[model samples]
Target: MAAIEPEATGFEPESAVRKMSGFSLKPAERRALLTILCALLAVRILAMFWYPFVDSTEARYAEIARKMLETGDWITPQFDYGVPFWGKPPLHTWMSALGMKIFGVSHFGARFLFLIASLGLLAVCYVWVRKLRGHDLALVAIAVMASAGLFYGASAFVVTDMAMVLGTTMSMAGFYACLADKSSHRVWGYLFFAGLAVGLLAKGPVAVVLTGIPIFLWVVIGNRWRQLLRLPWITGTLLTGLIALPWYLLAEAKTPGFLNYFIIGEHYKRFLETGWQGDLYGSAHARAKGMIWVYGFIAFLPWVLFAPALATRGRQVLEIFRKDRTGWHSYLLAWTLSPLILFTPAANILPAYVLPGIPAAAILLVSVWAGIFGQPGRKTRAWVAVSMIGVAVVVFGLTTVAFFFPNTLNVRSERELVQKALETSPDIAINYWGDRSYSAEFYTQGRLRYIADSATLEALKSNDVRDALAVYSHDIPRLKDRLEAGFVDLGRFNRRHLFVEPPLQ
Candidate 1:
C-alpha cells in the first residue's frame, strides 16, 4: 500500500484528470461546429452568386476596377469615358483589379476578391468570438452575421463596404488581442499594423478613428490608461502614413481637386451637410432619430432578442464599478457606445457605415446569451429556433426582391447590349449619356471608343458613323442633340435609346 501511494504521488491525480479532460473532444460537439460553419458558408455563397450586379454604383465600381486591370494603370482609376474620376479610394479598386487579373474580368471575376474578403471577415469574426466569449457563442455570432440581410448584401457586392468591414474587423481583433494579453508585445504590434493597413485599404484615417477611439477609451476606463503610452504610437502613425500617402499623392498629382473632392467634399461635407448631392446620400436618406435604431434592429436580427439581457449585464457592470471600479465590462461598454455616438451625427448615414460596431454587438450578444442561458434548455432551443427563422425570412426576402424585380437597364445587364450596339455600328464613335457610359466601356472591355459631353461629341462627329452607337437614358433628351446628322435610331432596348450612324449619304 505504501509503495502504491508513493507511485500515485508522482503525478497528482487531480492534475492528471484535468489534463486528460482538456484533450477530450466529444463527437457531437465536433459535428455541431462543422455543421454550423458549413451551413453558414453555403447560405452566403448562394445569395452572393445568385444575382447579377445591380446598376448605378455597384456596377460602376466593378467596371472601374476592370478598367484598372485592362489598362495596367493602378495609379489612376478611370470610368469608361477615360475621365480621371476619384469618388472613392483605390483599395477596393486594387482588390478588384487583382481579381480581374486572376479570374479574367467577368462579373464573377471582378467581384471575386470581395467575396474572398467577405470570407476573411467571417473567419475573423469566428476567431474573435471564440477568444472573447467562447466556442459556442462564436458559432452563433458567425451564423447570425453571415445570414443577416445587410451583411449578406455587402458580402455579395463588389463595393467598398465589404472591404471596410473586413479591415475594421481585423483591427478590432488585433485591438482585442492587445488588451487581453499584456505579456506579449507582438499583440500591440499586430494592433498597430492592422490599424494602419486597414486604414490605408479601407476608409482612410476614419478607419483608425473607428478602431482607435474605442480602444483608447477602453484602456482609460479600465484603469490601464498608462498602457496607452506603451503602444508604438509614432511608429504606427508613420507606418499608416507610409501605406496611405502614396495613393493619395499619386492620385492628387494625376487628377485635379482629388483631395478636395475625396477628403473635404465626400468625407467631410457628406457628414456635415444635409443636402450633399450625388449618389452618396441626401436628406431623403438621412433619418437621424430612427434610422440607427432601425438599423440596429435589423443588423442584429434574431440575436437582438438578447439585448434586454445585455442591458441587465450592463447594469451589473455598472454596479461592479461602484465596488471595484476595474473590469473588462467597462471596456466593453466603451467599445459599444463610442462608435455609435461618433457616426450618428453624420449628415449622410447608411446602414453599412456602422458595420465596425458589429463586433461589439456580437460581444454584447454573446455575453447576454452566456448570462441568461448558461446551459442548453427549452429557452435556449426557442431562442435558436427564432433566430433561424428570422434569418431565413431575411435571406429569402432579399433573394426574392433582387432576382424577381431586377433592374434590367442597370449597368450589369445593359453592358452586353452596349457592346453589341457598339460592334454593330463601328464606323461612328459612340457617345454615352448619363451613367451608362461607364458600363458601356466595361462591357466593351475598353475597346470601343466613347466620348463624354458635347465637346467630345463635336470632335468625334467626323468619324465614320458605322463605328459608333450613341446611348442615352430614356429620361434625358439633351443627349439626343449631340447625335450626328445622319445617325439613325437603332430602336430602343432595355430602356436605353441606341442610335446608329448611317452610311455616308
Candidate 2:
C-alpha cells in the first residue's frame, strides 16, 4: 500500500497539509514524539504495577480470576465461589488468570496482559497507517490515539473492552486487506475471522455487531458487495464458531440460563430498555438516549480539537466510497462511527461502550490534520506536549495523592488492609463486617470470610481463637458495641479498619 492521497481521507485535499504530507519529521521532533510516547507508556506501566485494584470493577474481575484459578473452573467465571458470573464471557478473565498464574497474583499479574493487548493495538495502528500514509502521519495518529482519555486508561486498565476493541480493530484491518488487495488476501481473510473469534470470546456477539456494521455499510454503499466474496466467508464463519461456541456451550451447561440471560437480556433488553433491571451481576447504567455521542467526544477529547472540521469532513470521507479507489476512506469512516451509531438509541450505555471507535477516530483525526495542515511544525509539538505531558502530570499528581494523602480520592482497595491483617497474625481468617470486599478476597487468596451474625462473631471470640475483623469505617461503632474492648486496632485502609483480638492471658 502506498501513501494515500491526504485528500482521499476525511477533508478537502487543497490544504497546506496535503503538501506537507510527504515530509518526515525532523530528527529532533521525531525523537521528542517517540520520547513522549515511551514516557506515557512508562507512566501507565508504573501505575499498573503500583495501583491497587479498586472495587466493583478492577478488583471484582481480579478476584474472579483468582477464584477461577483456585477452583480450576476455566469454563465459567464465578461471581462468588460457586455462583457463575453471566455478565460477561471469559476471555479477559482467562488473560488475567494466565497472567496471575505466570506472574503471581498481584495487580501487575492480573493486569499485565491488557498492557500487551493495548500495545498490540497500537502496533497495528502504526503499521497500517504507516503503510497508507507514510511514517510522519502514522506517528501523529498513534500519539492522538494513545493520548485519548479512553485509550490511555484502557491501555492497562483491566476491563473486557480493550480485548473486544482489539478484535474490532483486527476485523477492520483484516477486512481492509481482503477488500483492497486481491494479490494477497488469504491470510488477511483468516485474520478477519480470527478477530471475530477474539471479539466474541472477549465480550460477546456485540463484537460482531460492532465490526459488522462498518463493514456492511462500507461494502453496501461502495457496491463492492462482490469484494466481500473475496473473503473466506464460509470458512471464516466456521473458524469463529469453532473458537467461540465451545465456551458458550460449556458455560450454558455449567450454568444453565447463561444463553437466555446473555444473548437476550444482555445483548437486547439491557440496551433497549431504559433503567433495565434484569442484570444479574451488576446494576444497569442507563443514561439518556444518545449520550454515547457526548461520551464519544469526551473519550477522544485530545484530538477532538478538529470536531468543527468534522462537520464537513465526514461527508468528504463518505464521498470517496463512490470512486472506490481503495475503500480506505469508507473503511475508516464506518469503523469509527459504528459504535456511536449502535449505541445512539440505547438508554443503557457506559462511556466504555464508546471504546470500540477510538482507533478509527484517531486515524481519521490525523488524516483530517494532514488533509488540512500538511506538515508537522511548532504547533504540532506544542499540541503533543500539552496532550501527552499534561496527562502525565495529572497522573503524577494523582499517584502522589493516592500514596501520601491516602484518603482524598477514597480509593477502594483492601490490599493494604490484607497485608496488615497478615502481619498481625497470618494464621487466622479475617472477616469483612460490612459490604463484601473483593479486593480482600483477592489479597487473602480466598481466606476472607464474612461475619453473618453476632453469634458467629461471639463463638470465634469465646473459643480462645484470636480472630481478625476488617470493619468498614461506618460499621466501627456497631462492631465496638458488639465486642467491647480486648481488641487491637491494626490500622486503617480507605474505608476499613483491621482489628485483631489480643491473646487471652
Candidate 3:
C-alpha cells in the first residue's frame, strides 16, 4: 500500500472538515454511537419481555403497584391482602403505578419504568465518566455497566433498586458538581435537591447517612471543613421535607402503627436482627467476607478482570490527593467503602444494597483505562481491544444462558402450579399459602384473586366460586383437609400437588 499522507494520518483533510474541532463528530462516528445506544436499549427491551416475572419480591411489588392503580390509592402500598408492606419506600411503587395506568398491568408495562430508569443510569455513567476521564474510557465504563448481569436484571424489573440506583447516581453527580463550584449557592442547592430526592426514594434517612456522612467526613478530614456550613440548609431542608412528608403523614394516618413499624421496627430493628431477615442472603452484619467477594464478582461481571488495574490507579489518584491536600479522590473512596462497612451490621444484605457504589467503581475503572491507554500506542490499543473482545464474549454467553435457559433453572414447581391456574381459571380468586401469592400473580398477570385464610377469606366468602385453588404448604394444611363437598381434583400440576376445581355438575 502507498504511504499514508500526513494529513490523513494525523488529521482530516481541510476540505473534508465540515464542523468545529474537538467535539465535532464525523458521520461514521455518529452512526457508531447511535448504534451502540440503540443496541443497549434493544437488549433492555428484549430482556424485559423474555424474563418471566420471578416470584415473591419482584412479582409482589408489581402486583402492589397494579392494585394501587386499580384502587387509585397512592398512600398505602398493598399486595395480596391489605397487609402492611414495610420493606421499601413508595417511589418504585409510584413508577410502577404510573406504568400500570399507561400500559394496563402487564409485566412489560410494570417493568418499563425501570427500563427507563436503567437507561437514565447508563446515560449518567456516560456523562460522569466523560467528565472525569475521556470519551473512550467513558465508552468502556458504559459497556461494562450495560453488560453486567445484576444491572440488566434490575433494569428489567419493577423494584426499588433501579430507583435507588438513579437517585444515588444523581447524588454522586451533584456532589462532584458541588465540589467543583464551592462558591456557587446554585450548585449546593442542586446537591441538596438530589440528596432529598434520593433520601425519599431509598431506605428513608439511611440515604443521607450512606451518602452525606461519607462526603462530609471526606470534606472535613481534607481541611475543607469550612465549606460544610455554606450549603443552603434551610431551603434544602424545606424542599426535602416537602417531597418526603406527605407520604409519611398519609401512611401514619392510614396505618395506625405505621411509624413505629416502618421507621423503628422495620428499618432499625431489621438492621439489628438477623433472624427476621428477608434477604436471600442473611443479615448485613452477619455477612461473611466471602459474600462481599461474591458481590464484587457478580456485580462487576466482565469488568472484574480490570478491577486490579482500577484499584491500582485509584490508589495513585489518592496518593496525588495526599500530596496536594485535596480530598476529591478520598471522597470517592469513602463513598464507595462506607456503605460496605455500615451495612455489615444489618441483618440482611443484597447485591443491590451495594449498588450505590457502582458509579464510583465505574469512575475508578474509567480512570484506570484512560491512564493506561489514552495515548496512541500499539500495546495500549492491543490491550484495550483484547479487553473489549473478552468482555463482549462473556456478556454474550451469560445473556444467552440467562434468556434462553429453561424455566427449570431459576423457578420451582410452585411457579408451575401458578401457570396451571392461569390456564384453567384465568380470572378466579386464588387463596395463597400466605405472602406467597405473588409468585402466582406475577405469572398470571394479577388475574388471580388472593384470599388469606384469616382476613381475605372472611371478606371473599360471599363471592361465587364453585371451585377455588388453595396453595398447599405445611402451614396451610387446614385448607387442604377442610374442602367443600363434591370437589374433584382436576390434576396434580407439580410436586406441591396443586389441584383445580371441576365444573359444577
Candidate 4:
C-alpha cells in the first residue's frame, strides 16, 4: 500500500477548519476526539463498580491473578490451587496481579491493566492513523472507535482481547509504515517486531497468524515481493523470539505437557474442531462459522448502521478477494477482512476475536464517511451529534439498568450470590457442590472451594470445618435431604441459597 502524495491530491485543507465529508473540522477536532475518548473511559470506569464480575470469564481471569498474587507464583496462572491455567499466557495475569498488589484484589484492580491497554490502544491508533491518513481522518478513526460498543466495552472489562488488540494494532501499523513508505525509518520496522513479541505474550501463536497472514496476503497481491526483503526479518525474528520465548519455555518446564495442551489443544483444536473437544480447562463456544461476521456487526455497533455507504464500495471490498490496486485502501481491506476469513471456519468464535480488525474497520468507515460527505456545505454536524446522542442514550439506559435493577441482569447474578454468602460468613471458607461460580472464588479472594457431592460436604461438616459455609443455587432443592439433616439455612438471594452447620451449644 503506497501513500498518495499530498501534492497529487491538491486538497490540502487548512488545519484550523479542514472540511471532511462535508463536515467542518472546527479546529477543535483533536479535542473532540480526546473528549469522546475521555467520555468513553468515564463510562467504563463507572461500569467497573456498577457491575459485578461476570462469571466464567471476568471472575475467572481475576481469580487466577489473585491466586498468583497469593502464592507469589508468577510463572503459572492458577485456576485452582494446583491446577495450571493453560488457556492463556501469564502476561495479563502478571499485569492484573500487580494491579491487585497495588489497588487491592477488587474489580477495579483486576481491570486496571485492561484500562491502560485500552488507553494505550487509543493513543497508538490516533498517532499511527494521523501519521498515515492525516489528522482529520485520525480524529474520526478515534471517535468512531471510542463510540463502538465492543471496543468501548473491552476498555474497562477484564479481558485479554484489548491487550491482543493493542499488539495487533502496533504490528499492523508498523507493517503499514514500512510497506507504504519506502523512506520509513528503522523504528517502524522495530515497532513491528516489538508488536509481535508483545502479541505473542498477549495471546500466543494466534497473534502471529493474525499479524502475519494479512501482510502475506497484501504482499502477494501487490507483487511487492521485494518489500519483504526491506524489513529486518532476521533481527526482528530474533528480537521477537528473545522477548516471547522465555515465558513459554519456563511455563512448559514448570508444567509438564503444557505446550501440547496450550498450543495444540487450545490454539489448533479450538479453531479447527467444532466444540473443541480437546479443550482441557474450559468448554468451547461452538457457534456456526457465520457468527463471526454476525458478531462483527454487533461489535462495530452504530458504525455498522452505515452498511449502505459501505456497500457502495462493494467493488473495493471485493478487491480483497484477489490481487488489486496497491494502496492504503487495499491494506485496510486486507487488515479488516483477513480476520473475518480466518475466523469464519472457527469452531469457537468470540466477538472479541474480531477486535484486532476494529481499528482498520474504523479507518475504513472514516474513509467512507469522508467520501460520502466530502462535498462542501453539507450539514453533517447534526448527524454526528445524533450519533453521539444515540450512543449516550444506549449508555444511559444500560447504566440505569445496572445501577437500579441489577437483578434483572441475570447474567451477573452469580457474583451477587457470592457477595451475599460472604456477607453472612466473612470468616469462614465457602464450599459449593454441583456447580462452582468463579465469581465466588474472586470475591472471596480465591477462598471459595468445591466438594464432589453430599457425602464430601457432610464429611467436612462432621469435622472441625463444619463452620465452613455451603453455597449453591436454586438447584439446592436436589440436596434437600442433606441440608435438612446436617445444615441450617442462612439466606437466599435471587436464585442462590446459603447453608451452614448449626453451632454447638
Pairs that clash in candidate 3: 283-347, 283-348, 284-346, 284-347, 284-348, 285-344, 285-346
Q: Give the better candidate number (2 or 4) by TM-score.
A: 2
Tens digits of per-residue lDDT for model 2 on 1-505?
2222323432223234324355467778889889989988888888887777788788898899989988988998999988999999999999999999999988888999999999898888887677556677878788889888888888887789999988988888887766555455777788799999999999999999999899888767767665667789899989989988999998888889999999999999999999888988778997999999999989987678757755666666444345445566557878889999999999899899999999998887777655555565687668767988877777767766765665688988887777777887768768777678888898898987888677877776676666888877777776686656556787677788888888656
lDDT of each: 0.62, 0.81, 0.60, 0.74
TM-score on alpha carbons, each prediction: 0.75, 0.90, 0.77, 0.89
Q: Candidate 2: TM-score?
A: 0.90
- Position 235, candidate 3: lDDT: 73
Clashes of each: 12, 2, 7, 3
Model 1 root mean square deviation, Cα atoms: 7.8
Least lDDT summed over 10 consecutive residues: which range in candidate 3? Answer: 1-10
Q: List per-candidate RMSD values in Å.
A: 7.8, 4.1, 8.1, 3.6
Please give the lDDT score at residue 334 for candidate 4. 80
Model 3: CA > 4 A from native: 1-37, 132-136, 182-188, 277-290, 310-326, 376-406, 412-419, 425-435, 443-498
Q: Rank the candidates by lDDT, best first.
A: 2, 4, 1, 3
**Candidate 3 C-alpha lDDT tens digits along 169-288:** 767666555444434545645665665676666567677667776676666666565555545667767777787787888888887776776677656766667666543222334555
